[model samples]
Target: MLKEFYPYEYARNVFAIDYKKLAQMGYTGLIFDVDNTLVHHGDDSTPKVDSFFAWLHKLGFKTILLSDNEKSRVERFNKNIRTQYICDAGKPDPKGFLKAVELLGEPKDKVVCIGDQIVTDIKGANNAGLASILVHFIRLPGEKHIGKRRYIEYFVMWTWKHRRKYRHRLGDILRSGK
Candidate 1:
């Protein structure tokens, strides 16, 4: 069960990922979690985010925003980025991930889901048999309390980092052609 929370890859941030390498790996689609994963929770897209999406499109990758947040929240964040989105996605459930794959018109193996939360984003991708990249969540200002789940996530991430067997790097995968 704990293994389900393990992501296929981990990155410091979305901008830190090598999309070109992923495209070379035959990954044609990307499903993203908007809040924290892309920007701080409830924050609007920045020029950096806009440019990133444009660069992704140029690399021939189809993208989608999949979030558990309400439609309006997702819509507001996606307004300038302009990607297809599924709001109120009920993630950690395979349904939303599978739906994103269908919407991307790509095979499950050809799609990768990127997000900050392990339980929701990584587990959902694992459950749906798609690849996943886990990014560290962006911390919001004045955010002192993170709740119980975050503590558990921290422990999980600690284990994932310290245990060599559990660590998977995207660069390593790309180099091995796996």
Candidate 2:
């Protein structure tokens, strides 16, 4: 079950990855998960977002933002980023990932996802068959709301923080290219 989980999904603090390096990696597309991955959760917007989006735009690679949040929330970011945004994505579901892939206009083998959580962003990226890169959370936990998924959130954070213990398996999977 955990095999379907994504170890990446983070836009920050991920394994050594440079955006421009995608060309060398042969990746033509990039996928992002908003909320805690790109900006502080519940913040409704990002600081210096124009520059961040600008970097992606300058990369010449297509970018997409995938989120489980409602369309309105994703729309809030549409104006800032020069890419397609998919909301109500229900990560680990692969629907949004597929949509992003479809919108990317590139081969799936050349796309990667960046997000903060395992159950959602990371898991979804794995199921969607994209390279996963985990990043540290941009917001504090209090930013998350009180809900059932909150438990899952805690569990994922535990796994991420302890990833060093299980990292070898993750490395094998990523390297195997299966």
Candidate 3:
């Protein structure tokens, strides 16, 4: 059951994701988590992020931000990035993922969900029948409450890294869950 939280893949950060490869692999849409996935918690978009989104557009991938934050926060953060978004989205819920796919007007099999959290992002994408990519958070989290959740995620990630049949192909860096 814990395997349900495992991501289809992991990357060092959002910038590390290969958009070309994703497009080539037939993923036409991307659903992203805004917080730690795209930027530091509660921070606005960076120039790098802006460029990345532009690149995604150029590469023919429709993008959307699906965040658990309030509309104000999501709107404020998206001002510079300028992607379609749904705020206060309940993650780990199939509804949000389905809604994101609907917003993109794409089939579920052609969409990929990207985020930093396993409990929400990976689980939700898996449940919604979308491919999921887990990326390391841009910065250390400020909240103390997330530490325990992080610990739990580490255990599950460890299982995937050490025991899964595909672990050998993931290499040490990603398996380390740095």
TM-score of each: 0.91, 0.74, 0.88
- RMSD each, Å: 3.4, 5.6, 3.5
Stretches off by above 4 angstroms in model 2 are: 6-16, 141-178
Tens-digit lDDT string for candidate 3 (1-178): 7767888777888876667767777779999999989888898888888988988999999999999999999999888778899988898898999999999999888888889999999899889888888887666646445567788877888888775653423223232332
Pick out the ten consecutive residues of candidate 1 with the lowest summed lDDT: 169-178
Q: Which 10 consecutive residues of model 3 have the lowest summed lDDT?
A: 168-177
lDDT of candidate 1 over 33-129, digit per residue (tens) = 9999999989898998988998999999999999999999998988888989999999999999999999999988889899999989999988998
Candidate 1 residue spans exceeding 4 A from truth: 162-165, 169-178
Clashes of 3: 0
**Which one wins by TM-score: 2 or 3?**
3
Better of 2 and 3 by lDDT: 3
Residue 111 error for model 1, in Å?
0.8
True-vs-predicted CA distance for residue 102, candidate 1, Å: 0.3
lDDT of 3: 0.83
